[model samples]
Target: MEVSIIIVSYNCKSFVFECIDSIKKLTELITYEVIVVDNNSSDGIEDDVVIRYPDILFFKNDYNGGFGYANNIGLAHAKGKYVFFLNPDTLLLNNVCQTLYDYLELNNNVAALGCRVYDENLNNQMSYGKFPSVIQYLLEVFPVKWVSDNYKNKISSEGYLTEDLDLDVEFISGADLFVRKSVLDHIGGFDENFFLFFEEVDLCMRIKNAGYQIRITSQAKLIHLMGQTMQVSFQKFKWFEESRYVFLRKYYSKKFIVFSKSIFIFRYLFLWLKYLDKEWHKRAVFIYKLK
Candidate 1:
């Protein structure tokens, strides 16, 4: 096969259906198979999906094993030269799979390629960026635009909306990542250590360490209906914070981790005061005292 498209599905039934339909309809001239790993979604959408898209390979985990692990499951079953880890909330604007495949065929040095990602409303999303550090994470939390502006100047814009075909980036979101299967096999796939966030960053880090560049291309495009399956909730926030800690510990120093936690606590405390959601307040407090 030319490409194996793997989607780690959750409870987004209609979104996944639309995503698969777009793939089937838009993708031509490339041989690809769709693998859907249902991470214990309780909505019974898996049954409907299986009945609707009989060509798709469907598997269900006994329990929710988180994103990275579920993707690892799909990777184990993949049988293509290239593997595309796509989110079920995405829609192909064109023949993105073939475009990415052609990019890899021509480039030869890039280990992974991500496409320009937009929201359902067509607003460009920040889908590629520098590898996260304490400073980068803190800048994201606080609204200091000047500091962020300087950072962007140094590292270049994380969000690529230009007409340039190739944009090199430190990491790309797993939401629409296309990777060479050989490179993935060499690095042993995504680090399953991350439960929700930073898994893609970790994978990109490994790919870079193996002397390969990760890039973004404007030639291919996709609409990511961000947060379709998982809405913003206190639990989701906790998972993000926990995964951030995991990433910091894995890649940075203890001093940096402590500094990040301190800034995160202060920022979230201020946000809690401003928003005044009791549930969010309690979760923010829990995160503050997480260590």
Candidate 2:
């Protein structure tokens, strides 16, 4: 098989069909299989996949295993030369699958590839970016956002190196990444430790560390309606506080962990203060006060 397209779905019956329909159309140059690993979605995803494409491989988890874990499960059964870790809400642009395979085959050093992505409005969305740093994270908040979003600050407007047009990047979003099975086999699949976010960055970083090229394919475009699988997303405000600590524990030294944790804590404090001051927060506060 040329590729195994793995889609890890969670309560997204709202949109999975369209995504699968697009992939099913790619039956031409890309001799591929579709693996839908559903995370126990109550939205009838299992029956939908079976009823719509019975021949398609679908696995329903008994529980909601995180995104990384579900993709790892799907990859364990993937038989293609290349594998795609695609989200359920993402749609492929014309011939993008074939393009990625051909590019990877020609460039043997490229371990994994990500394509240009657009929002639902079809506006460009950044798919790759510089490795995260403490200073950069701080700059993204409050006083710096105005500056970053204005005058086309190369860092903000550029997102994560999209300007180079077909270049190697430090990390690419797993939302739609293509990977050679050989490279996946060499380094193993996504680090299961990452329950949801940053697994792609972690995977690309590992591949690059192993001397493999992680590419962003500008020619192939994908449409990602971002944050579809996510729920309770104001909670994302806490991902840095929680996951950054998790990341530091895995990849950084003890000293770095201590420093990173402090910054993470401070950021969380700032966010909590802002959250508390919001109208929604005042209503909740009033309810609590009445109680």
Candidate 3:
């Protein structure tokens, strides 16, 4: 197989169908397989998907093992030279699989490649970024508009959100990552400790350390119905924060983690007091519990 497209689905049944349909409609130049690993979703996706698309390989887990763990399961069964880790909430806008596959075939030094991503409205979304740092996190949570805008502009200038040309990058969003299976095997797949966010960032960091390039190309494109797969709630926020800390712990020193946590606690506490918002207060308390 030229590519093994692995999608990890939770409760997003309809989106998964749309995503697979787009892949089937658009991908033609290369041989590929679709592997869907259901993360114990309550929705009856297994029956419907199997009946609708009998050629798809499907597996069901007893419980939701988070994003990385579920994708790791799909990765183990992958039989392609390249593996495409795609989100269920995404739809291809072109022959993205063929474009990325051809790019990798021509550039053997690239460990992973991602394409331009757009929202449902077709506005470009940030699909790649530098490795997370304390300063970047602080800028993200800063309250002042001018400061935040300046930081965003800086990121854009640094090519984190560029869409006009191909560039080497530090991390690619997990929403549409295309990587070689051999590189993944050498790196031991993804770190299962990450339940959701930062898993791909961690993988990219390791890949770069192994002297392979991580890149983004404008040739391929897709639309991501952002945040549709998982509902927004305080519990979801908690999972994000938990994964953030896990990532910090893995890539940073204990002292650095402590300092980062302090900054988080202080920032959230200030926001809670300034806005008198319950959400801010909840986030502050959550960060305190992590200490």
Q: How many clashes show up per model? A: 0, 1, 0
lDDT of 2 by residue, 18-104 (tens): 888887775466688889898888898776678878877899999976888899999999999999888888888867788889999
lDDT of 1 by residue, 87-134 (tens): 999999999999999999999999999999888888887678786665
- Any residue pairs clashing in model 1, and if so which? none
- Candidate 3 overall lDDT versus native: 0.88
lDDT of each: 0.84, 0.75, 0.88
| Error in Å for residue 156 of model 1 | 9.1
129 Cα displacement, candidate 2 (Å): 2.2
* Range of the 10 consecutive residues with the lowest summed lDDT in candidate 1: 153-162
**Pairing residues by index, what is the TM-score of model 1?**
0.92
Using lDDT as the yardstick, the better of models 1 and 2 is 1
Estimate TM-scores for all models: 0.92, 0.85, 0.94
Error of 2 at 237 (Å): 4.1
